[model samples]
Target: MTPHYTESSLRQPRTPHIRMPPFTGKEGWETWRAQFEAIANRYGWDEEERLNQPRLEGAAAQFVFSQLSPMC
Candidate 1:
């Protein structure tokens, strides 16, 4: 005997998709940060919590370092 699957089960469930708007300058970064903070808040995440952990010193640090890197 084979297990049965419902049409709904076979179909992917719909989920809310949140995307940040494009940034053009310092204002853009602030806008993006606001959206990020909102999403974090929705999931009960504290932006400051990560600060409690040891600072990243390798490839992991680049994630944030690159974001703040000066542009040409």
Candidate 2:
């Protein structure tokens, strides 16, 4: 017999648990960009994750949010 899909069962995130280090603007942009691109390439991040997963935190994250609209 076939099975039915429930809301709870359908609620799994496709992204993995791996998290990039939070960007605090202390690191050089070139070095940070390289690492970010590398991880995204390795993990096959889609557009949404690419925009949202820069790992910005604290004031840096707030600054970004204030500067731009939320995507996720």
The numbered model that scores best in lDDT is: 2
Worst ten in a row by lDDT for model 1:
49-58
Please list the residue runs of candidate 2 whose C-alpha ends up more than 4 Å from where it truly belongs after superposition: 1-15, 62-72
The regions of model 1 sitting more than 4 angstroms off are: 1-27, 47-72
TM-score, cand. 1: 0.30
Task: Estimate, for each residue in 1-72, the C-alpha lDDT of model 1 and write its tens digit.
Answer: 999999988754232344444333434455656776676557554445322222344444565568677553
Model 1 sits at a Cα RMSD from the real structure of 11.0
Cα lDDT of candidate 1 equals 0.50
Model 2 Cα lDDT, one tens digit per residue, 1-72: 899999987965566787878887777768888998998888888887788777777767778889888765
Superposed on all Cα atoms, model 2 deviates from the true structure by an RMSD in Å of: 3.7
Instruction: Please list the C-alpha lDDT of all candidates, in the order they appear.
Output: 0.50, 0.80
